[model samples]
Target: MTRTAPHPRTAVVACATYLPSTLRTTAETEERLRVENPTLTLPTGLIRRITGVENVHVAGPEAQASDLAVAAARRALEQSPGEVDLLIFASGSQDLIEPATSHIVSERLGTRCAVFDVKNACNSMLNGMQVADALLAAGQYRRALIVTGEVPSYAVRWRVDSREQFLRSFGGYTMSDGGAAVILEAGEAESPEPSGGRGILGSRFLARSEHWGVGTIPAGGTVNPHSEGGAYFDMDGAALQAAFASVGVGLVAETLASIGYGVDDLDFVALHQVARPYHDRIVEVLGVDPERTLLTVAEHGNLASATLPFQLAEARAAGRVGPGGLVALVGLAAGISLGAMVIRL
Candidate 1:
């Protein structure tokens, strides 16, 4: 017996992104690091400048995360400009370990909606979309707002040798300080068919726990114990590349298949920005249209969990994504985790 697919009930209303005003050049990063650790030899240059810092000028980790989140949420709200029913904050990292970041943003935004945080490494934004869709489908809310913010600079490990090794730590350069927000609303359509609102068609996620350590903050976790030493991100570059080629590629193919659409069917694809090499590999593996693949890693680097949604906003603003178009948002990160979804418009 065959089964019928569930209908899409929620569609994205409006979306926007926030990028800090400050800029930190590659030379500046090197100079700043030289003061603390003179042995640093940077990669081809992937560092970016962020705003909201003190006399130091460059944005500190926590400040970058918060500022980006606030700015992006504001932009999204302005785009939609309505009373939001719910607010969800998604991020791989946050401004603080205590006091949920969503609550902080909610208070600042003057929003009285339900507030919370969603996290799953880099796939947090996509996961939040799934949750928002579920709530809207169930009629729990009429409209919901999703916000994602990332500050990779804080977790970056800067003291490494070799340009090859430096390039390995290049996730720092792909690190962007930004945030994104999108408004999700209950579709007016009675059936599952796509409409002007462009309801969510479907989504799939795959994560390999055994490979969670492929990329991680080594000293901060419970087992590693931050008390053992100062905590920092420790990436097994070799392992990550291997996983990207094997598990990462397989997951994208599988999810796209589940949704009954191949990469070619997507009008546009917005993926998590890690490094150009990784992007190239995924594009090659998926066999997607090069023109439709949007990238911001060069300018903004990887904004952790915020990458996908931020890209969505850019594509929408440029008129690359719109009503009746099919878009796929893909996010791949540390857990060897992958997320993808096919949405109409």
Candidate 2:
């Protein structure tokens, strides 16, 4: 006999996000492109605007990873004042490799609850929510804070000599720096209805390890040794395209079925902001309602880990999503990973 999976009880109470103040427009990129590679075909200003980013602070040796978290947390607290019982920092851009960045954020936010970090390429936020939901279900914590801080600008390589390298700068210009903080609380009948009492139902992860090298920043890790070489983000764009085409279809279909619903049941779907053509294909194939899908790539660009919360915030502000809405947050990025989660709001 097969046993049924139980839905977990959880709710998102408040959310806050920060966008860097600096700006980089596509026109600027085109101008630079003309100077660097006169032969390279460039997207028109309107077509390439998402390749523009603005108002960002470059994280550096002296920059504390917790600074972005603290800024977002403060705003989150102000938005919905509370005493959090757990803190989870999700990112692909941690300040360091050793000591967890969560510790610094917890101390700065004055949250004494358990603290940890979750790293999973761009899906880090969704992964954090899954962990937070599990902890809440286990009675390990009553409330949790999920935060994401991005510094893609810090990873850019501006002096490369190859045209291939010039085109790759899309990652930098197409990416933006920002942070987000969200408060999750255990559902209570008296919980004042919560921002919708949206409980996380289930999540699915698809990791295609074989394509791990398709999209990555090769230079600074254990493999290449940053000390001996110049490190910058690199990608086999063709391979990533194939991966998205194949994995996106199955992962999305399975996720919807796992929740006993079709993609049409979703009131809103938030996908990772890659600003690529494949994003449109996935939405069409999944039959996700165009009106319900939030696309931030054209404006905010692709924020590695902060896309989920940023889109959710947009949906909320626009009143496009509300109580009783079924929301799906999906992400696909480096590591050839794809993740989808269904939340009942």
Candidate 3:
């Protein structure tokens, strides 16, 4: 039997983003790498040419992932201080492995909302959005706050033995520190002012567990308790590229089809800020106009789960997304997962 789709009752009311003050330039990073490996020979502008990232933000030593989340959450709350019935801390970076980070975020925000964490690598925010959409649609909750704080710089290994090691860790240079929060409210509730059908319409998610090892942190988990590679982030670049080339486009197309829309229907698209090449490939595969999407990698690099929300907020501020316009938020995570959410703004 076919099942009916859930009506979208959740709408994003406000969004806020917080980027760290410290900036790490590509030249500085290249210099550091060269100093560590004397024999290394890389083109002067190779990093920028490949990733289009000139600089990235670095969190202060005293800062933790939860701290950033709280900062962004406070800003979002200030914009729409409605009673948040639920809070989801969706981030790849966590303050601790024991207690849920959502609790800490809620405590700092002074909200007694029910809290939890939803992790799906870089797609954590999109996953959280899907969960929030469900709860709000079911009438189980009226408002939900989704927050992500990414401090990936901590996992970057500066010293490498060879070019292979450096290449494997290249993704690290693109890592940035930031936090983002979005306040979602049920659409059935009357708004103080009229919004032209601005809210989440639907979302689709796909996972390819076979390619799970394409991007991973080899240490710190039960599988590798001692960490053969010092718990640094590692990825098989070629494998990841191949996987995306094979299935990424199909996944996006299916997602759009689920909502009875196409790429042309999107007014603005917010894609994960992995790198310039990845972004270009996604735009090409999805047949989306590059001008319609916001590119943040050039300045902010990859903020993981915080990237999409940050881009969305910036696009809104620039008036790229307006009332009744459709916006597509797409993400690809380390689990070899793909997800797309179409929202009417």
Candidate 4:
């Protein structure tokens, strides 16, 4: 039997995730880095010691971002059989820069639906859903599939020439390669509640683009298109932490408060995870119970745009939240953007 959604307005029908079979442990990753960078004294266990990520998923060398998305999309489609009128490839990773990656995903899925791309660092999936929900509400389409695949492993620096260089690549170590897809159907869902909508209720986002340079994969753009040296990620971990700190938790708190519920009052919350310490700090400051949130980064590493969707799937499997359940999705992306969305599952 096909899994069906109970949401009426821009309701979520199905959500699925795909993790490559290969699991690369932090110890293995450190040894590999040390082996390739003989001149640099890279410390072992520091990755796990600092980030609390025990292992991460690694896609095969032959796998591209599109491949990952396709894998997850297939599962979602199989779970809920229906026509997908629009497809969106939203992620921090891509197979190539020329044609939109959504087209490639559509080709692999054999879907002749309208498609597009939305890339906004780690918040790509959230933004894609935002677009899809709005369009669905406007009657632009009947169903929308939002998919993401992240492959930060490929850009991870193997040849660390110096201690400083290794530090810049540290964030890459906490990243995992995987894919996730979410399906949202447009209709009036049957809800017993007063307002009577099950899908996305409201969303709010705040950004300070000035801090965009704090994190980046400097290649593939017009500025450094031809340089292999510019390919790997270069990030200031301290700066990124501080940037999010300065932005404050007002965005999330306000969003939840606007709906007359504090974060603790909600059944579930999906927060974009990067490192364990950061995750702890976020939940503590937000005053959300640890039991209500998913500490996914430590186990799955940073899934980038696939994170929020992954948490949603986990919640469903655990029976924490389902149809007519209240939930909130929060995102912290590299462009120094913070977003929060309230939803009735």
Say which prediction, candidate 2 or candidate 3, comes out ahead on lDDT: 3
lDDT leaderboard ranking: 4, 3, 2, 1
Residue 101 in candidate 2, Cα distance off native in Å: 1.0
Query: Which window of ten consecutive residues has the lowest lDDT sum in model 1?
Result: 49-58
| Clash count of each predicted structure | 5, 10, 0, 3
Q: How close is candidate 2 to the true structure, as a TM-score?
A: 0.87
For all candidates in order, the CA lDDT equals: 0.72, 0.74, 0.86, 0.88
Of the two candidates 1 and 2, the one with more favorable TM-score, higher being better, is 2
lDDT of 3 by residue, 11-108 (tens): 88889999999999998889888888888897797888888999999999888999999989988988898789899999999887769999988888
Candidate 3: Cα lDDT at 98 = 66
Q: Which pairs clash inside model 3?
A: none
Which has the higher TM-score value, candidate number 1 or candidate number 4?
Answer: 4
Off by over 4 Å in 1: 1-8, 30-36, 39-64, 159-170, 190-197, 219-221, 224-228
Q: Give me the runs in candidate 4 sitting further than 4 Å from their true place.
A: 1-8, 189-196
lDDT of 1 by residue, 14-103 (tens): 878777666666566656655555666534332433211111112554484657777888887777788988888888877676677888
Please identify model 2 stretches exceeding 4 Å from their true place.
1-8, 33-65, 188-197, 225-227
| Model 4: colliding residue pairs | 8-187, 8-188, 8-189
What would the TM-scores of all predictions be? Answer: 0.85, 0.87, 0.93, 0.94
- TM-score, model 4 to reference: 0.94
Error of 1 at 197 (Å): 7.7
